[model samples]
Target: MFNLIKNEWIKIFSRPGTYVMIGLLVLLVIGAGSVMKFAGVSQEPEGDWKQQTQMQIESDKQYLEEMGGSENFQTQYYKQQVAINEYRLANDIEPASGESIWSFVNFNSNFVEIIGLFAIIVAAGIVASEFTWGTIKLLLIRPISRTKILLSKYITVLLFGITLLLTLFLLSTLVGAIFFGGGDGQPHLVYIDGAVEEQNMVFYLIKTYLLKSISITMMATMAFMISAVFRSSSLAIGISLFLLFMGGTATQFISMKYDWAKYSLFANTDLTIYTGAMQPLVDDMTLGFSVTMLIIYFVIFHLLAFIVFKKRDVAA
Candidate 1:
């Protein structure tokens, strides 16, 4: 398995396109940092944070009153905001102020989507390309079982994805530190079950990045499955990329009128919804439920890929 994975990794990095994708990711992070540094995007507000907090509390209260009796997601959002802001005032914990390394890292979290895009591209092509280039015959001619080969390829794809994520995190941190100061040691305040909790900023950022990767991981796995089942990288990439961009929006639209939408892959992909950051699409969806759903989907995708690949006729 180690040798197989190593071979697969070598194959992935051997291509110029792989380097291009990585180069693009690096350039994007640096470009974004440069833009924010030069555009005078101040992370700090001018007035007293206490005064600003009070103003925000007042605004939220007014909005809540205006939205009374209409209990929906927006109402819940305002209520969460009100609770968090009030907690900030009561605890005298000032909101994050001034650009810092942590702040820049948080900002760069948006680039996770780009990482997912590149991963999906790689996953979608990895298996299908073997067949496309008529290398599957040579690959299967080895003494290794088909399952091991497929697993090795899948593991390699995962390793590649992890490499991209780490590059993003580390590169963002470097650029952030260079452009912004080290950090101000601010605690990340999170609202949970009607209470605000203070968490280590670094730990919170790392957790945030991991949570955000769930959707991408699923999409990449699905792409890999498609690639294995159908010997066409173009088709696999097309479907995966399309859903990667539009699946969540379409799922949200359906969720507005249908509670069953909660069972959707896209709906549950965002585990952050369970963190009280926002309301779930369905009122009853919980973290446990989403995790279970993801596990089911994960198993199903792998089962389809492995079963098909093992039984597939390569003699043609």
Candidate 2:
């Protein structure tokens, strides 16, 4: 299995496109860091964090009053922010004030979407390209079972995705440190259950990275399944990108009026909602429930992909 996975890994990196993807990631990291430095995105607060927190709370409260009994999504979001800012001030916790490695990674978590897109591209091509290039027979002629071959390819795709994610994190951290200096062991302020708490910056960043990667993983799996079943890399990539970019927005809109939206795959994939960064669309949604939903969808995707690949005839 190790040897097979290694071979598959080699095959992935052998493609020029893989190197291009890595290059793009590096450029993006540097570009974002430069932009932050030049645009004053990392300016330090003039007053104490408590003062800043108070000002934020007051501003949000005034906005809430202006909102005047409108319980729309935007109002709820502002209310949540007010609660969090108030908690920060009361607990003497520092609100995020300036740019640092921690802040950079936290903000750049959005780049995980880029990583996801790259992973989808790889996954969409991994299997279908074998068929497109007439390499499936060459792969199967080896001394391995069909299951092993499929597993190796899948494993390699996951490793590639993980590699890109780590590269993003590490590169962003290095660039951030170069520009903003070290964090001096700052703590991330988190608001949960009507309380403010402190968590280690590194730990929080790691958790954030993992949670963000979940959406990428699910999207890649879907792409991989489509590639295997349809044997068309273009089709697989196109459909997966559409879902990656649009599915979440569509789910959010549907969730506004429908309870069933809670069970949608997109709804469950973003585990960050449970971290108190935002509220769940449904009041009853919980970490455990979202995790369960993800597991179910993950299993279904893998089962379909594996079953189809295993039963497929290379001779055809």
Candidate 3:
């Protein structure tokens, strides 16, 4: 199994395209850091930070009161803002004096979608390309069982996905530090149970990263299943990318009128709601419920992939 995984891993990195993808991602992070550095120096003089924070807090309070009766997502957003601002005011945690490394790293979280796109491309192609390139027969004729072969490929793709994520994190942090000093420890303020709480910034960032990556996992799994069943990398990649862009929006629209939308794969894929990023689409939705739904979908995806692969006939 280890050797198979290693071989698969080697195959992935053996391609110059993989290196190009990684390089492009790094360049993207650096470009974002440069833009952030020059965008706004926050010319607010040092002495007025407290006053500024206090004013922001009061404004948020007003907004919160105004939004008190609205049960939509925007209300939850305002509530979260109110909680965080109040916490910052209470804790005397002024905003960063400038764009620090921590701020840059935090800002880079928005780019996780790019990482997911790379992962989806890899996952979408990894299995189907074997057939596309006419290497399936050679791969299966090895003494390895078909199940182990598929598992190795899946593991390899997942490892590749994780590698891309970590690359983004590490490169963003290093580049951010180079551009913005590292003196400030990025701290996060979270709203919980009608109150704002201070949490380890690193922990929050890592949690955010993992939660956001779940969509990649689901899309990759879908692509892998499509590849195994259809033996077409382009088809798998097209559908996966289309869903990646439109799935969340479609899910939101579905959730507006349908209670069953809570069971949707996209709805559960975004685990950030559990971390209070927003209110659940269904008031009854909980972390456990979403996890269970995801697990069911995950099992179904793998079952389709493996069953199709195990029975698939390769023309010599």
Candidate 4:
């Protein structure tokens, strides 16, 4: 079983597309960092701090007039602006824009949602590709039990998942730090119960990133089950893509008609969206509900995959 998993891992890493994906991730981080770094240095200073601050005040006043000045996120934004103006006045700090590229980089550094999807595709295709390419016969002829073979393939998918996630994390942080100035190491703030508090933002970011990785694994498992049942790689890919896009849409109807819709996987996919929507959708949500839905979705997908894969005959 161990050897089988190792061989599967080798196969996954050796694929040309794997390296291509890695290259793309690095390029995105570098390109994003470069754009922001230059943007800060290149912008002409908005000199005359007093005038600039007044301009912001007028802008906020106009916005308040437009919205009738409700106590909302916009109002909060302006309140902070007022504080910033006071700070600038007291300290004699010109509105000198420093390299905030690192902040931008840090904020976006953990966008592993789509990147992790690529990992899911690779994993889904691992066993399915062997079948598609007529290599299943060779695999089945080995002395290993069918369950052991499947377990090995699944373990390889996990290793592939972890490797891809770490690659995104380390590379983004390293490149971001180098291209931009070093971190201010401010507390990463997470919102709970409509209040923002200083917390371990870095750790939270990592935990969220890992959660995205798990979501990708769930996607892979979904594809694997489809591939196992349908015995067609194209069909598997089609189903995965359709569900990937439309799942949330379908869940919306359920939410309207039935209370059970909160448990849909699509509802949980974008943790960012669910996290006290900075710009919330109608009927804003709770974190507990989203987390619950995701857990059930994953468990059911894996259970279905195991059952169907174990029962299905390999013959084409």
Candidate number with greatest TM-score: 1
Tens-digit per-residue lDDT, 27-120, candidate 1: 9989988888998557678879999999999999999999877878789888898898998899888887777889889989889988899999
Report how far residue 150 has shifted in candidate 2, in Å.
0.5
Q: 1-316, model 2: which lDDT tens digit per residue? A: 9998998899898999999999999999889888888886546678676776778888988999998997776786788788767766666666555777778877788899999999999999999999998989988888888889988889898999999999999988899889888885757666666665677889888898999999999999999999999999999999999999999899999988998999999888888887767778777889999999999999998899989998888896
lDDT of each: 0.90, 0.87, 0.84, 0.66
lDDT of 1 at 178: 95
**lDDT score at residue 240, model 3, on the 0-100 scale:** 85
> Which regions of candidate 2 are displaced past 4 Å?
47-52, 68-70
Clashing pairs in 3: none
**Model 3 collision count:** 0
TM-score of each: 0.97, 0.94, 0.93, 0.75
Q: Assess candidate 2 and give its lDDT.
A: 0.87
* Comparing 1 and 2 on lDDT, the stronger one: 1
Candidate 1's TM-score reads 0.97
* Model 3 regions more than 4 Å off: 39-47, 64-68
- Write candidate 4's Cα lDDT for 133-230 as tens digits: 88877988888777787778877777777776787777767776777656555454444444444445466567667656656776777777666656
Clash pairs, model 1 backbone: none
Among the numbered candidates, top lDDT falls to 1
Runs in model 4 lying further than 4 Å from the true structure? 39-107, 245-261, 273-285
Candidate 1 wrong stretches, greater than 4 Å: none
- The lDDT ranking, best first, is 1, 2, 3, 4
lDDT of 2 at 272: 86
- Clash pairs detected, candidate 2: none
